[model samples]
Target: MEQTETPPPGRRVALAVLGLSAMTIMANATVASSLPGLKRHFADVAGIDTLAGLIVTLPSLAVVITAGLMGWLADRMDRQKLLAFVALCYGLGGTSGLWAESLNAILAGRLLLGVGVAGTMTLGMTWSADLWQGAARARFLGLQGAAISVAGIVFMLTGGALAGLHWRGAFAVYALILPVAVLALLALAPYSRERRRAAPVAKGMARQAGFPWAAFAFVGSLGFVFQAAFYITPTRLPFRLEELGVANPLAVGALMAALVAVSAPVSLAYGRIRRHVSAMSVFGLSFALIGAGFVAHALAQDWHGVLAGSVIAGLGMGLSMPNYTTWFLARVPMAMRGRASGLLTTAFFLGQFASPLVSAPLVAHLGLAGAFGAVGGTLIGLGLLLAVAQIWWPEQARPETAPAAVS
Candidate 1:
C-alpha cells in the first residue's frame, strides 16, 4: 500500500479536541461541586458517606492505571479515531452521575470517566506535538491548557448554578455536550484508522530511558495543588462559609469560579512567557505565589484572605501548568511522547489522588487554618526545593538540545 503524506491537525481539529476535554474538566468540576447533592440519592445505598467522595476521586485513580496505555496507543494508532471513541465514556460517565440512584452504578461511571480523561489528557499534548514541532507545538499545547483551565471556571460556576435546581442538572449538561463532540470530531476532522510509524526498537527504548524525570515529579507535585484546590475547595467552601455565618452557597461557588477563571488566561500567557523566562522560573513563581497565598489564607481568618490566596495561587498555576508538559516533552524523544505523556499525566493525577489523603489528615489534626497552612507550607517547601534544583542544576533551567524523534 502507498503511504499518504502526514496531514496536520488544523485549528478545527484542535477546537474539537478542546471541546471534548472541556467536558472532561466540567465532569471534574461537577463531582467536586455536586458531592453534597449526591448524598441524598445515595442515602439508601450502603456505605454512602465514605463512598460518595470516591466517586469524585476514582477517575484520577484510573488516570494512573490507564494514561500511559492511552498515550502509547495515541502514538501507535489512529489518534483521532481513538479520541472519538473514548469520548463516549466521558459523556456516559457524567450521565450516570446524573441518573444513578445506587452507589455502585456511580462508582462504575466514575471509572469510565477516568478512562476518557486518560485518553484525552494524554493525547492533548502528544497529538499537538505530532501536528507541530518546536515553538508552534508549544503554543498550541499552551492553548489546550488554557482551554481546560477556563472550563474549570465555567463548570465550577455551572455546577453552582445547578445546585439550586438540583445537582443532577449539572451532570445532565455533559449529555448535551457529548453529541456535539461526536459531530465536531467525526465531521469536521480527518483522521485515518492507521498510524504512520515503525515500531520502537531497542535503541529507541534506550533514548527514552535518558529522559528528564525530575521535572516530571516536580511539575506533577504542582498539579496536585491545581486539581486539589479546585476540587476539594469547592466541596468544603460552602460549609466553611456557612460555619462563619455566610449563607450563600452560590456566592462561595462564584468565588471558586473566579479563581479558577484566572487559570485559563494565565495558561494562555505561557506561550508568550516561555519566550522570555525559563520553565524553571515559571515553576518557581507559580508555586511561590500558591504557597504564599495559602499562608495568607491561614492568616486572614476572613473571606478576603481566602480570595487573596486563591488569586495568587491561580495566577501561579496558570504560568506553571502549561509549560510542564512541553518541558517534559522537550527533554524526551518524540516516539516516546506517548509513554512520556502517560508517565507525566500519571504523576499529575497521582498528586490529585493524594490531595484528600494528605489534606483530610491535616484538617482532622489542626483545623482548617492549620490545614491551609500545612498545605501551603508543603507547597512552599516544594517550591524551594525546585528553586534549588534550578539554581544548582543548570540543565533543567536551560533550553534543551533536540534529541532524536523516536523511530
Candidate 2:
C-alpha cells in the first residue's frame, strides 16, 4: 500500500485565513465610530448614554456568551465549512443596523453579530495553529496581528465616513465579508479535509493529554487584562474626542484610525521581539506602553494631545495580541486548538464588555478624563509588578517550546 503526502496550504489558503483574521477585529471596530450617531438617533430611548456604549460592545458580550459552543463545534466539525457559514452570518448580522427601525432591533442585530464573531474568531486562531508551527507560526501570528491592525484602520475610517453620512450607513461595511466567505469555501475546504485525514495521531494524543485548564486560565487572564485596558480606545476615545470639541464622525474615525495605525509596525516586529524576550516580559512592556498612552489621554488638553496618546497606546496594542496568542498556542496540543482559541476569544471580549461596566462608575465620580487617569495608573502599576516578577522569578517568564511537529 502506498501513502500520499498532504499538500501544503497554498497562498490562496493563507490569504483566506488572513482575511478571516481581519473579521474578528472588524466585528466591533466597524461600528465604533457610529456610537455617537446611534445615541443621537435613539436619543428618545431610556438610558441612551450607557446604551450607546453597549452598541459598540454588545457583540463582545455576545462573543463571551457563545464562544464556548463555537469552540466545541470547531473541534467536531469541518472547519472550512463552518468558517464559511459564520462569515455569512457576520455579513447578515453586522448589516442589520442599516434597516433596524429601533434601538432594540439594532441590539438584537448586534447580538446575532456576536454569535458570528465567536465562530469566525475561534476558527481563525484554530486554523492558524493547524497550518503552521514553531518560529514560522510565531511569524505568521505577528503578521496576522499586523493585518488586523491595518483592518482596524480601514474599518474605523470607513465606519466614520459612513457615520458622517448617517449613523446607519456604517452597517453596510459588514456586507463586504460576504465575498470573504466565498473565498474561504473555495480556498480552504478541500485542503482541510485532506489534512484532517492525515492527522489522526494528533487528535488521539490531544484526547489523552486532556485540556490544560491551569495554563489556559493563566493565559486567558492575560488576554482579559490586556483587552480591558486596551478596549478603552474603541469604547471611550470617541467620547473623549467629543469632550475636546471634535464633533464630526469622520474626524472621530480618523483619530480612532490613528490609534490603530501605530500598532501595525510594532505588530510586524513581534516575531523578532519574541526571539529575545520572554512572553511574560513582552506582556509587561506592552502594559507599560498602553498605561503610558492612557495617562497621556487623561492629560490631553486638546485633540493633538489625544492623538499622541493614541499613538503611544497603539504601540502596546501591537505587541500584546501576538504575545498572548503565541504564548498559549505554543503550549496547547493540536486537537485542543479550537477550544483554546475559543477560550482566548471569550477572555478578550469579556474584557471589552467589562470595560464600560468597570469604568462607567469611575466616570461618574471622576469625570471622563479622571477615569482614564485611574485606569492608566492601575495598568502602569500592574506592568511594573509583572516586570519585577519576571526579573525575580525568571523561570515563570521563560518561553515555552512549541510541541514537536506531527509529521
Model 2 ranges with Cα > 4 A deviation: 1-8, 32-54, 99-105, 164-167, 239-252, 392-400, 403-407
Best-fitting candidate, scored by lDDT:
2
Q: List the residue pairs that clash in candidate 2.
A: none
> What is the lDDT of every predicted structure here?
0.67, 0.81
Q: Write the per-residue lDDT of candidate 1 for residues 1-407, one digit (tens) a residue.
A: 11122444676777865675565575455656577878876677788888977877788888888997987786576666777767788778867877787778888988888888887777666655545555555576678778887777766666667765886777676675566566555744444332343334523664645655675565665665655653446555555556556677666766666666777788776766776667776777777777777776667666777777778877876777667776667656656677678777777787667666767877789887777787778778877777787787653222223233332
Q: What are the per-residue Cα lDDT tens digits for candidate 2 across 286-366?
A: 888899999998999998988888898888889888887777876777777788899999999898888777878988999
Cα-based RMSD of the predictions, in order?
4.4, 3.9
- Would you give me the overall lDDT of model 1? 0.67
Q: Over all chains combined, what TM-score does candidate 2 have?
A: 0.88
My TM-score estimates for the predictions, one after another, are 0.84, 0.88
For model 2, state the Cα shift of residue 372 in Å. Answer: 2.2
Model 2: lDDT equals 0.81
Residue 94 alpha-carbon offset, candidate 2, angstroms: 1.6
Poorly placed runs, candidate 1 (over 4 Å):
1-9, 32-37, 98-101, 176-232, 235-244, 395-407
